[model samples]
Target: MTAFTRGFRLHLADGQVLDGAEFPSGRAALVDDPEFGFVTGAVSVEELLLGYHGARIEWDDEALLEGKPRPTADSITSDQLDALLLKAARADSTWATALREAATVADGGRENDCGCGGCDTCAQHRIGLELRRRADERDGGRP
Candidate 1:
C-alpha cells in the first residue's frame, strides 16, 4: 500500500470537503491537457476549482452517491477527469490545431476591434460592424 506524503483538502462553499492523498506516484502522474480544457473550458486546477464551485451552486446538498457524499458543482466529475486524461492523450493534436489556427491568423496583418495586437484584414474591418451586429443578436442585444 502506498502511504501519503501529503494530504490536500479543499473546503467547498457547500460545506463539503474534498480530500485526496498526494503520493510521489500521483505527483508524477499529474499533467496538463489543453483540448480537454478547450473543449470543456476546464483545463487547469483553477478551472476545475471554478467548475466544482459552479456544480456546488447547481446541486442539492442532500444528494449522495453509493453511500458517500455526492459532489456539488464544487466536486470534480468523471467527465472532467476523463477530459484531463483525454487532453493529455491528444496533446499533439491540440498543438497542431493551435499551430494551424495561428498560421491562419498570420502575424503583421492589421488589428481587429479587440486589438489582439495582430494584423487584420480590411474585409474583416469592413464586415466588423455586421459581425458585431450578429454578436449583439446572439447576446440578446446587450450593449
Candidate 2:
C-alpha cells in the first residue's frame, strides 16, 4: 500500500468526494474514514481513469504523487482516439458521414459476419450504433 505524504481528495463525476483515499497495492483506492474505519469495497482506479460507468476521477495535484500520472491526449489508446473522433462526429453531419464511410471501408463492407452486434470484428456496425445513439441523445432521446 502506498501512503501519500499529503493526502488528496477523489472528486468523483457524480459530485461525491472521497477524502484521504490512498492507493492500495492493486489498481484500486482505499478509503479509511476516522468514524467509519476502512471503507467497505475498493474503488477501481481503472474505471475512474477510463470514465467508465459514469464515473471519472479528477485527480488533484497531490494524488499524482501517490498513483499514476494523469492521462494526457497522447497517452490515450487508438480505440479511445477513435471514440473521441466519433463523439465529435456526432455534432457534425459531414464528419459523421465521412467517419461512417471510413468505418465501412475499414470493415471491408461487412455488416455482421458473426452476428454479434458489438464485437471488434464489426467496427462499422459499432460506429453506426454509437453515432445513432449520439444523435438520439441530441434529439432528446428520440430514435
Off by over 4 Å in 2: 1-8, 20-24, 32-35, 41-44, 47-52, 62-143
Q: What is the lDDT of residue 85 in candidate 2?
A: 62
How well does each candidate superpose onto the true structure, as a TM-score? 0.23, 0.26
Off by over 4 Å in 1: 1-7, 12-87, 107-143
Ten residues in a row with the worst lDDT in model 1? 57-66
User: lDDT of each structure?
Assistant: 0.41, 0.51
* Candidate 2 accuracy as TM-score: 0.26
Q: Score residue 23 of candidate 2 by CA lDDT.
A: 53
Best by lDDT: 2
Residue-level lDDT for 117 in candidate 1? 38
- State the lDDT of candidate 1 residue by residue for 42-132, as single tens digits: 3333444565553332212122232233333557589755755565546645554454344335422232443543325444443444444
- Model 2, residue 111: what's the lDDT? 44
**For model 2, how does the per-residue alpha-carbon lDDT over 29-68 read when each residue is reduced to its tens digit?**
4363546766533455554345434544544642322355
lDDT of 1 at 63: 27
lDDT of 2 at 73: 49
